[model samples]
Target: MTAAPTPPSPPPRRDAGRPRGATIVAAVLAAVRAELAETGFEGLSVERVARRAEVNKTSVYRRWPTREALVAAAMEGLLEEFGASPDTGSLRGDLHALAAPIAELAARPDGVALLRAALATTAPGDVRGAARQRVGPPVASASSIVDRARARGEWRDGADPQQAVFTLVGAIVHRTLLEHADPTGEWLDGLVDLVHRGVSADPPP
Candidate 1:
């Protein structure tokens, strides 16, 4: 029987030097993170990030479209700094687990500097809108720990998860970014206790 017409072979994937596209993205992100660590967000620029990353500004702008977009992307690199909040089943434990990373970062000069820079600058281009897209997942995960605690009858029904998240997190941001002081675990522990007492359904015996 005549062989069925062979289906045309799929076109071979073209290299088009596109393999480096992902690498470039990674490099640029790394550069931004490095700059934030060293100089803070205030010192960041597309050119600076590109220079640190060993890439050209054109490539960075082309990939990100705007400075804000790039900043948002850079902030995303901090994902590793954020961790899953502990479900220790105690409000204090849960809050401490959530706040510890933030406190640690706030205490670090690099982290504090970057955050200060981020807060000081006007968001470039579509960056403000893109920020929630980038930081939201981490924020949501952290907040979920609180939600779980509430479900367990640990926290009061009036507790606002988003507000709580921001309140606790904002304290770190304030000390690190604005106050320009070292944040300590002892301080963080106290803050956690304060927040827990405010939200706990039952007062500590």
Candidate 2:
């Protein structure tokens, strides 16, 4: 029998190569990250970020009213898009799962760069506030997981779901962004252990 014709190659992705919104965001973020890694906060500026993103000054300014706003928007987008939520059955497992990407991001070049930039500024305001608020959805999503666990009696009725989410995120932020230290899985596990000790009730024999 004649050999079957080879299947046609898949169509190239249309959006993959374009300079669309995602591209703009990615380019600006990468540029900002690079600058932050090199110069820390003093180096980050609207003009610099715009040049790096390869977009005009108008585009950057229109989207972000200020330097802080730009930085916050970039950070919020990065965290929302790349970070995974905790969902394993046990709290420890869920925490570990959440921490894995965080540890990896903390150790990444871009992540280090972004952290440096974020540290230089006071808390975000105005446009920055809007961007920071974007975190609400993901934060709520993470909280729901913990709440479900609590409902199942896997966790104590008094468990603070919000605290659990923050603790997990904060550990990674502290190690990678603030301390400028490489985040290790062991370190993440330590964080989980600490939270567990604080929150978990002793299981009956």
Candidate 3:
């Protein structure tokens, strides 16, 4: 009998040699956030994100196939610095530190657009939460800042950590996105002072 003919080999995967690790994850997530800010949720496309990330579309699809999943993954890495507010040693200091960067971000056009994407009522749930994480994290998901403050007996009567955080972030977003004003350092200080007083167990100085 004649020997069976050899079978043809399957084609290699498009990302066969691509490095799949933190580097790829970081690039992909970064691309998704930039995409969300510029093009927004409605305009976001896997192809564009892949191109910006310099990775194969297959790679992104393999990790985050759905819009919700992609946005959630993007959020997982966003504003991570804000997640852990270091021991500023006082509630006022902590609040100031936390508010400063958010204010700074709001001052930029990209930041304004980015905030618009997050605060959009029509955006998917996860995308909305990502921008809110600037303050949200300090309350639940991210840090010990609130816990530390509570332990120090710093919070005033009926002042909830969640609400306190929301208030601080909300002011920044309103000023930068709605008012279309720069979140100047001077302004941030004033905002922090106001929020600090509202939440502090002691009265404002």
Candidate 4:
């Protein structure tokens, strides 16, 4: 009969109807960082992160699959927040510009704690890989500075670009974590000057 016509089916669920993955990912990562900052990695858990993020546990698992992976992702976000590379047109200026912000980040207790937690839990290779990613932009910036210096005959062509980057960063990290020293303006300036002198192609007139 005409009265027996079937009712129309409901519309299919679409990804467009759900929260954007980027938003969810940001929230989750933020939560992970917060957890790390508050409780350190030893106290971290999927449930705690899920609660903090207000997302399902399954969602966190789907994305990160493990606590270490989640922490790595959060640490990666922290590195990204360090901002872009500096290009002040000279090697010294670039080093000065880059050193200030990195020192500032190292000064933050939460930032240092997060770094420690990641180092404690994650594999050394993985940590190094993440570090490479974190430092990639700054290294490239330093390389550009090196290139400019070479063009101007301020630096030798055979200088190692990576060594230049590591020198400043490694020293900052050492003083921050080991010596318990502030990476103050005076310290940073001296560090830059020292590195510049060591790497310069010719003695300053």
Best by TM-score: 1
Across residues 58-155, which tens digit of lDDT does each residue of candidate 2 receive? 77776677776666665655455544465677867766665666567668876665556444554344433443354344456666567656766667
Give the alpha-carbon lDDT of every model. 0.67, 0.65, 0.73, 0.71
Stretches of candidate 2 off by over 4 Å are 1-26, 40-42, 46-73, 82-86, 113-124, 127-131, 134-138
Displacement of residue 67 (Cα, Å) in model 3 is 2.5
lDDT of 3 by residue, 78-178 (tens): 45665567778898898887777777766754465467667777777776776566445545632466678877888676777777777887888788766
**In candidate 4, residue 140 scores what lDDT?**
60
The clash numbers for all candidates, in the given order, read 1, 0, 1, 0
lDDT-based ranking, best first?
A: 3, 4, 1, 2
TM-score of each: 0.66, 0.64, 0.64, 0.65
lDDT of 1: 0.67
In candidate 1, the residue pairs with backbone N, CA or C atoms under 3 Å apart (3 or more residues apart, or in different chains) clash, namely 42-117
Clashing pairs in model 4, backbone N/Cα/C closer than 3 A: none
For model 2, what is the C-alpha lDDT against the true structure? 0.65
| Model 2: lDDT of residue 103 | 68
Regions of model 4 farther than 4 Å from truth: 1-27, 35-43, 47-63, 81-86, 121-128, 156-159
What count of clashes does model 2 give? 0
